[model samples]
Target: MKAAVASALRAARRVLAACHESPDGDCLGGALALCLALERAGKRVVVASTDGVPAVYRFLPAWERVTDRVEGLGSFDVAVALECADLERAGRFAPVLAACPVLVNLDHHRDNTGYGHLVWQDPQAASVCEMVYALLAELGAEVDEPVATCLMTGLLTDTGSFRYSSVRPETFELAAELVRRGARPDRIYELVYESRPPSAVRLLGLALSRLQLSADGRVAWSVVDEAMLQQAGARWEDTENIVETLRSIAGVRLALLFKVEPSRVKVSLRARDGARANEVAARFGGGGHLGAAGFVARGDLEDVVRQTLQAAAAEVQTGSG
Candidate 1:
């Protein structure tokens, strides 16, 4: 870890950061967390994402500086990719990885392929933000208010507000510490969970309307197509919350949400109880936690629907208690 940090500090004097497309809570939170930390180290920082930052995160410090394409992004001495497994997950900014002298890939996904020169993939760490926290401490960097806000947001979202099994005692302790450092839980919570446009609420209603149950009622599935999105006037970002309602019904152990994109289908997989969702997602080269994972599917929506439904059924039968 010392050698890794040494290499990081040497090459990270001027740094750029990238996250996955259609950024989720962890993706944006982790990248922003590290950018703020690196900036505090007196390094130049440029953070960009292909899918762009969602409105919920616009309040973060230096959030406005994030651009879709980081021009001269290759000129940075080092670049960091967060919360992404594959290098291709960087989308257009992928070349920035090769452009820099050093790359640090940090993620908690089980399927991470060790893409960066300095790789830290700990699936047990719950979130990439946790690994970043450890990295900051390894450098003996101070956790000021900006750093605390970004890290706290990362931890809060990835663990579902400390309601998931990943929430260890240490996680709570860290939360308290962040609060001590001036991270306001109420404001962030309201931004993440409560605030949403009216169109998103309508889209959520439509998604729930399409919810389907397994023959035994142990699995639930829902699909939201582009047409449905257009009808409801919902942006692709608005679909983030569509998956949770699928698992709300009693006895449902597995939930699936299929979001149709322009070229492919994106699948969100969630498990209740002790199911292993990351394993289920890895088949398609995507992953997350045992309870919440995602994958991108090729071909048509029907193909995606067929494959996901089949895979989900097998998981339900085999994963049954």
Candidate 2:
């Protein structure tokens, strides 16, 4: 994997790095970290994402470098894909990636579809940022302030502040090293967890009020419709982590949040007590980790919710048994 990555970097003078649609911190951080590393290595880099950097992540160093559209971004010698399950997960950048000569897929999701010229995936890694950190070290690129800050944000967010089961001993070791290199945990915590907009709080209230539990009390779900977004003046990004609120309810093993978009319902699923949310997501052509996954369903919101809840309930039953 290192040899392939090194070879790609050596042959590339211009690189394009991108993440998944509606990207979370892990994907964004990994992409940004790699962009910084490549820039330091004297390569021209463009960081692209369909959703761009979320408000919460704008505090990271060089966050402004992220661009939303890659339509006419020209050609690149290599494209680095971070935390994307498949090429389609790149969203608007799919065509741009197809135009590139080489794609280096770096991810840590077991369900990844494995579609890249140079693929390096490790489900065991807590996040793709961990893999990026290792890659930078392998390339002997300096982990400067910008790189450290970006990578640490990924580690903190993906691990749930070191609370998730995916975290290992090495996670902390690397985190400490990043801190030593100028990553500020206090500042990142403030930017990500503590800096919620008022609209988001209102949206959370609407979502919580609509939360419903399954007959067996093992499955829980909520809907954030267009009406709710309009009422609360919240964008879809503000709905982040709302499913975690549902999963926090006592006796709930599987939690789902369905948000109504223009022509699709964005679904976020979370599991507890061995329920594999990824399987439920996969039934609808989505993929993620064991405990968290998501998908976009194009159809009537009510119908999509019904189908998703049914699958989620089945997983809850299977997990309980």
Which candidate number would show the highest TM-score if scored against the true structure?
A: 2
Segments in model 1 whose C-alpha atoms lie over 4 Å from true places:
10-12, 209-211, 222-237, 257-269, 274-314
* Candidate 2 accuracy as TM-score: 0.84
Off by over 4 Å in 2: 209-212, 222-237, 258-268, 278-290, 293-314
List, residue by residue over 1-321, the lDDT tens digit for candidate 2: 967897788779999999899888988998889888889889999999998887778887788989997666888999988888889999999888877889988889887899989999888899889999988888889998889999999999999899988999999999999999999988898889998989999999999998899849998889998889999999887898799999999988889998888878889999888899999999999998787899988999878978888888788877753
Compared with the true structure, all predictions reach lDDT values of: 0.80, 0.88
The TM-score measured for candidate 1 stands at: 0.81
Cα displacement (Å) at residue 88, model 2? 2.5
Candidate 1 CA-lDDT value? 0.80
lDDT tens digits, residue span 75-138, model 1 = 8777788877788888888887767788877788777888777787777776677777777777
Q: Candidate 2 clashing pairs?
A: none
lDDT of 2 at 147: 91
Each candidate structure's TM-score, on Cα atoms with residue i matched to residue i, is 0.81, 0.84
Which candidate tops lDDT? Answer: 2
Model 2 residue 172 CA deviation (Å) reads 0.9
